[model samples]
Target chain A: MLEKGRISNIQMEFIMVPTIIATGVLSIPSIAGRFARHDMWMTPIIGSVIGFITVFIVWKLHQLYPKMTPIQYSEKILGKVGGKLFSFVIVFFYIHNTGIVIRQYSDFITGNVLKQTPAIIFSITILFVSALAVRGGIEVIARSAVICTTIFMITSLALLLLIKDLELGYMLPLLENGWLPVLKGSFIHNAWFSEFFLLAFIFPFVHHSAKKGLKSGMKTCLYVMLILFYVHFFVLTMLGVSSVNQFYPVYSVVRAIRVFGFFENFEVIITASWVLGNFVKVSVFLYVASLGLAQLFNLSDYRLIVFPLSLLLFLFSFWDIPNVVVLVDYMTKIQPFYFVSVQTVLPLFLLLIALARKKRSDHV
Target chain B: MIGEWSIILLVQVLIWMIVLFEWKNLKKASKANKITFASILILSMILSFAKLEYLPGPITLLHYIFGPWGWFME
Candidate 1:
């Protein structure tokens, strides 16, 4: 398996930070702002708690089984047939999530940047790029993320420059709806946070202690929360209620930056930078899904199946979800529970089972 | 019509080329690996040609299990 490429703790952090922030930076404010209102800034912070929980739980699992991924070690915990079934569940989850992510990117790009262009074009292209990244192996993906991190920093700075356009008054009337709405607003953000589970697929590939892994993940989660807080604050202040009504709130906020009325429409550059993050996101999930499939069948190499998997991803990207509206509804309503359950609750259970097994073995 | 077929054919050819390129390695892979590779390729190719209408997708599943979730967007 290409000698199981290894990335350092820092490269893993670089890989994860942009991976989590990419979609949230441009997408979360609008969705979270729907319920959050003036308190939208708080969602990411509260949401980060879920991220921390996910990191810790997955870290515990990693500590228990250092040599294998959750996919590979589930057999030890669940026993043969059950393990393969669980592995398929994890694989299918990632596959389905990757498809939805590609579709989300496709919808945003086709809806905003390339109007009249088919969403499939964006989907296929991004999948192709992600496939290339996946084929290059995790080390390659991590190194590429090192470069993309620069683009991400520049984009963040550009967003910071938009503060002059923000109307701080729009953030007034905080807690008008009490903490309930803020808590509700964090539901979707928690779903994003729950994505920290993907690190389980990645954690085994890194040579680090579980404590350091959790530290890196926690730090990334905190930084992502800060960035998401800024995004929500920026959009809510710049566009106010108009931000909630817009599909791409952060993109709209970026659009509002009119430097001297000539240096305008930075959405293209922001999106170009955003693509690097999306590439890492898709590549990571694709790599893990293929890895799971390979292990499920005991294949010698995961890269052998990347192409066919992309085909599945392309097809699934347009799966039963139909339009973006329904996609948004599903994501808002069902995805939070579904993702948290599958990504966190399942692993938490698996960890318990693994611990029990360990105790039983020690006794025996 | 013809254009759709062309697109589907193009995707199939592309997938086959990749699989075949790696077939040397896959040739020695387990029976499960070969079956998995073939099954996904064929399944995706078939789905790509199928009508999108026929696929009710996750929305319907969510609607059935979770119940009329479209209101959340409002």
Candidate 2:
């Protein structure tokens, strides 16, 4: 095993939830609002169906292999060359995806809260912190996740302060366009939800039965759905359709919170908490990329590559993305399909082939 | 010009620090491990000297494959 660490189902939940919700909450509401309008709150509810399906697929695949990650199992299921090709694609997809994720994090910080600071500085700092966590192994990431995710959940409660300012009328005229628009809104969300496939990398190291992992994975999906629904509800009610105009709708709505007519400027607290959440997000992806590369190349240890790969990730974040506008454009249009194809569709094929191969071997 | 040079210098410093820290492990590691580490490090160093924003990258490749489909969202 490349990783000797064993994590419980609960630790798995802690790591996985923030991995999805950390980035989803910041950008999704506005993107959903673009299509669903008053019906935007339903987007997460619809989108989480993909999360559930992805968790089941990952779980089923893990059940078949039981002792191997997708990197190892792909070689078992496909011929060695085909499997290596597939593994290379999966690993490269994640490396590229992680770069975009780091870019999104830095963009949020530099474009919004720390306008004077250079964006690369924020990326490097977060990548450096995450590199330390990745080097410590999965137990360290999960343990830190428990603390960071808790702070993220608590700070997110500040959104409740905006209850008085909500115009419930904005949510009326429900389905203003129709179910088609709501489906369109959920399309982008399915991309985020499909990230549930990341659990496959962690599942082999999980110390529980596959059943328990499945249950926790489903529960995490529910928790994410509710959290996203809660954020979208607030953003839609407080900002209405204007939420679509703001890049960071959750940040915008949080900025509008005025507690007891005295306490304001709470966006900074939310941003700080979000940093904690993104810390977990980036670390997990960094760890997966390093581990995946090690497994792909038959390296003795993943730790040696963490720093160098981070430098590559740094280069990737700045690669041809000139600004947040292009970043958001990529997310809305290309990312959904790109993420789904590699993470979801590819795994589905792997599962089907593995199942067929198993039945044949049984008959033989 | 100064800012760009400083950024390059900072990257070089970071690279050396990583190499120095991992030198002991690298000395005793397998040939595959050394080659992969050195290759990735060299790739990053070369890219760091160039303007990354102007470089054709994965995003550009993905855009070429999926750019036409992006219009469907409109």
Candidate 3:
């Protein structure tokens, strides 16, 4: 069981920021560009607005039951049966999601950094390491995030060394398609932005004195969003909108960075930072799945399930997708709603019900 | 994508073994709890396999019900 004294608000902020930023930073610019074209930078701002509304909804629910997770409050709002069913849905979703995320990071590493290496090796290695962290529980994961976030920030600053190659003309003719495309792209990005809903699971577990945890969380999310926008803007300005068509523009940008000839090939550093971020992201999801499973069974311990669940996740990561294209298609087309609903909508619904029930109980 | 079928099968068996090891505690679970757990497991299994096929028939049905909410990227 995770003890209540384990993590503080600052630690929680560290955990949430890197996990949300890591994978999205790599792929979002290109994905958003697919819809928004030259206007990709605006999508994050619009997405942030939508994201904050969703966060407000989640925060309102937390205010209703300041010390209960969605799982605990669901049972309070709905009866045991309904709540368990809802929790089961959420847990299963996390399991599937965790597998896909693990696969994504593995595929990315193998595709860019270790082209000759079999992706399954990377997949299993990452899952193995993450499973160990999950077993150590959320406190270890948060501390790991703090260290990884510092490293990530340092690597992000390294991109500044490439400013000489940047071309401001790439971001010109702003909103060539008008604001409509930007708004449409925001909806796609909104799904990505709503990932902060994971905070709902960890909120009740934070040490109570961690003042303004939600505010810190939202601020961290906005900071990450700002960083993402700036990174994408820098990549666009450096590589141009046409060059951004490549699958991993950020990696390409890193490869393009050449300082004094001796400082070239910075993709290695970006990949290393990304690997750490992916570790935190995967471990958080895996921990959530394990915790949800433990609660579903009313078990006293979640550690027993960690290794077994990770083994299953490793298998599921390679289950049937034969290539990267299929994986990308599934991620962009089919899976966004799965990511959004269980993580965002269902929690909001549970929060509303919990709030109403709290009011009713207080009236009595 | 390169894992041997045997490895995949072995991992699945290991998961079942762990679940079975925990089954004694599950015995005390209410009927509703059992139903929910079973449904979740079954649904996740179905979706996992559906990804193997090109279309993922059940997910398509879900997408259809959700009704063309910007997934097409047009």
Off by over 4 Å in 3: A1-5, A209-211, B2-67, B70-72
TM-score of each: 0.94, 0.98, 0.87
Best by TM-score: 2
**Which ten contiguous residues of candidate 1 chain A have the minimum total lDDT?**
A21-30
RMSD of 1: 2.3
How do the residues B6-71 of candidate 2 rate in per-residue lDDT, one tens digit apiece? 767877998999899999999998998998999999988887887777677888899998888887
Model 2 per-residue lDDT tens digits across residues A1-364: 7899989999999998889988899889988889899999999999898899999999999999886889999999998999999999989998998998998998889889999998889899999999999999999999999999999999999988778888999999988788998988898899999999989999999987476989998999899899999999999999889999989998888888897789999999889999999999999999999999999999999999999999889888888887888888988889888988888999999999999999999999
Instruction: For model 3, name the residue pairs that clash.
Output: none
Expressed as tens digits, the lDDT of each residue in A129-171 for candidate 3 is 8888987888889889899887887888888888888777777
DockQ of 2: 0.67
Chain A vs. true chain A, TM-score per candidate?
Answer: 0.96, 0.99, 0.94
Error of 3 at A337 (Å): 3.3
Quote the lDDT for A236 in model 1.
Answer: 78
Model 2: residues >4 Å from true position, as ranges?
B1-3
> What's the TM for chain B in candidate 3?
0.49
Clashing pairs in 1: A320-B57
